[model samples]
Target chain A: MGFGGRCFRVQWGPSALRRFRRSGCRTVRLSTVRDSTPGQRRVPRPVDDGDVPSVVALSEGRRHNGRVANQSGGVTHMTLTAVGVDRPGIVAALAAVLEDLGCNLEDSTMSILRGHFAVLLIVAVPDTIGAETVEAALAPAAHRLDLTVAVRPLGELPSLTSNDQTGRSRTVGGAGADLGEGEVYVFSVHGADRPGIVERATRSLLEAGGNILDLSTRLVGPPDAPVYVLHLTVGFPPGSDAAGAADTVRATLGEVGVQVHAEPVEIDVL
Target chain B: MPVRPVLTLPAPVLTCRARPVGSIDDEARALAVDLIDTMKVSPGCVGLAAPQIGVGLRAFVVDVTGHRKAQSCHGTFVLFDPVVDSASDLQPAREGCMSVPDLTGDVRRASQVVVSGIDPQGVRRTLHVDAFEARAVLHEIDHLDGLVFLDRVAGPHAVFPRKVYR
Candidate 1:
């Protein structure tokens, strides 16, 4: 797969699935269950009038089990997701719970979309704390705040290695090895919004043997005619023709009705 | 005079507002010489401030003679108790500091400036500087005020990690 294809996988969730379906995009529900741990399992109960008390009872039981699992030393990493209506104190409450559970927040992205607030966090917990333990601990806050919470254990990070085809070392997510040896440039494309814009631009650079270091896209302007803006940091091999590659990308994007501009990102050390 | 060790972030001396040089005594003259010597020793360094050498004195040395970016080239000079008389034509440019290594930021500084200070000979002088020379002077003045390029970054994303220096 190309660098953009591998790194820019669209996040699919229940709401996202529904939106995709409405937009006439083909999407499938990969899994309904949030947590994927084997031994301790709790199926998501359908929301109904009589099931509320039972759900609370099950959560309390899980919390009791979590107390027994609290041991010292071994560390486990997991991804935590929390979504609810926009309100103050949600982050503080979630942070308080994590702190109490002896978990460290490593990396996280939080933002408010429409009227809903979403938070995704990568946290490290002590070995004694399982995915169930984290979910159970968050139950009270989730219930009180009317939020959906899920926790799933993460696998080990993939080791970085050199790509045989390009003869250049590439890290997961397209972080090029030692930018000092390579030339870095900022590439920007802005114009009318259209499908396949991202794919086309990224494919051109990839074909030219350029690696994307970072990228972000935004759709702005009037609701009737939104403008698409794509900004990316790309790196080229030491002796590669960076200007030629950029020219090809510009011409390719220009054919698709987007204006392109590229400039070398200067870094001065004093 | 000898080349002194340049201080980085978290060094208390770099953060505190430097004290003015009351007079250019033997000690002050030696500090000026050390600043110039240290700037010469550090690769690609065009300027050095007293606070960078752990001395909280209002003094600095700048020499951008052969640098490509430099336009109003000043061979080499040292100043004590420097004050920016007037600055105009603000422009945003990427800058890194010896006192704040490993990171660079886009900071907006005046492109043209008139600065007054006492030279190494204890004589007062006013310099009309622009382009890279103005930038170097402004950067050193920031050090005297306990500020780095990080403080003047255009936005959060303006700061970037510097991979290498050669």
Candidate 2:
């Protein structure tokens, strides 16, 4: 099927934006809120606290790490990923170093992946700072905490969470106006565990003209008959066929013996 | 009545239990009016609690009239120190908040409820609410208790980020 639509295309193709790991990658919700940014509303979640798809435990004292963005006018985004053996004071030490470096923790996710403490941070670094300075600044903390770290700068950080007058939604992957601003929906799929499910399902959704916001897959049940569950948040630009996209996804995943449920994530204002 | 600014998350006032509005006095009446005014200004907002407008009092206004999801419409009414006399028929519903503006969560609330509270006219009224009306009542009451929809989510993925926060 031709992947042609009115949606804007990313420079690095669809796969370049988001990675869907096959075989064994369970999405975990790492809710480590260190400091609450005043007047800013976070993407509120029902925390199973230290448990999610794969249900990994959170490190200690990681308060306000993920949804802690108070910086208003920074256009640069530097994504930092750190992985190392799990231990106490890891998150706290990282947060302190980031704070000390004058780099604002725009967004962060920390979780124990495969028994390792993994942290992915979207930092708002001032123009005066560079990648080397960040990596060097974090070296001390990384060493003390026995962590491996890397940082890369992405161009033009879009305003997330807060709705600008434009209401233009741009994810970290730089899929700006290319992905039309529209209502967000959550698509949950589950079935017997099998290889190529992630690849086929994600590729089919893209072909069906859907913009993926977030996706996480989990494998559960006994090894004899494993059950794979995938939670995907997707959006379609205005005037796109949402129902049709859902049907296409349903059919595509069904071929691989998966059941699908698509629901619009409408937030009723109370 | 003025359309007061609604506070978002991390605001200490939105998390603390509100003080009781013992009587429907002028101050209580004013709080009720502001709640109504604020709710009216925001399109798609069916309910507003006193704490949302920075008033730490147990008061709120709701008007689900003509709302598509509303089955039992309660034109428009304000309550002071509202109390849930009975709530039954638990159901899951997606809810967003003016205080917690950026995300919505699938929260389980009663589909039917009997709530008693004093109105703006200094008269006590017991409301029989169901469907969306009941959800709105419970949501407002949650605000008075310093709780938002985030506190009642069913699971981690139950919450979804809003593309736009009004």
The top-ranked prediction according to DockQ is 2
**Model 2 chain A: ten consecutive residues of lowest lDDT:** A8-17
- State how far residue A220 of model 2 sits from its true place (Å): 2.4
| lDDT values for all models | 0.69, 0.68
Candidate 1, which segments miss by more than 4 Å at Cα? A1-86, A94-180, B164-166
What proportion of the true contacts does each candidate reproduce? Answer: 0.21, 0.33
Predicted structure 1: clash tally = 1
iRMS, all models: 14.7, 10.5
Q: Kindly list the per-residue Cα lDDT of model 2 for residues A1-270, writing each as its tens digit.
A: 133212111111112112211212223333322223332433322223332222222112212344233445433568899899876556556556665555556556666755678888887666677888889988998998789999999776554454433432211111122213566667999999988887877887788677887877888999999999999888776767877888888898888788989997655667
What is the model-wide C-alpha lDDT for candidate 2? Answer: 0.68
lDDT of 1 at A72: 37
When candidate 2 is compared with the true two-chain complex, its DockQ is 0.34
- For model 1, residues A64-131, the per-residue Cα lDDT tens digits are 22431223336677999988886655665676677667665544566565667777787667777799
TM-score of each: 0.68, 0.75
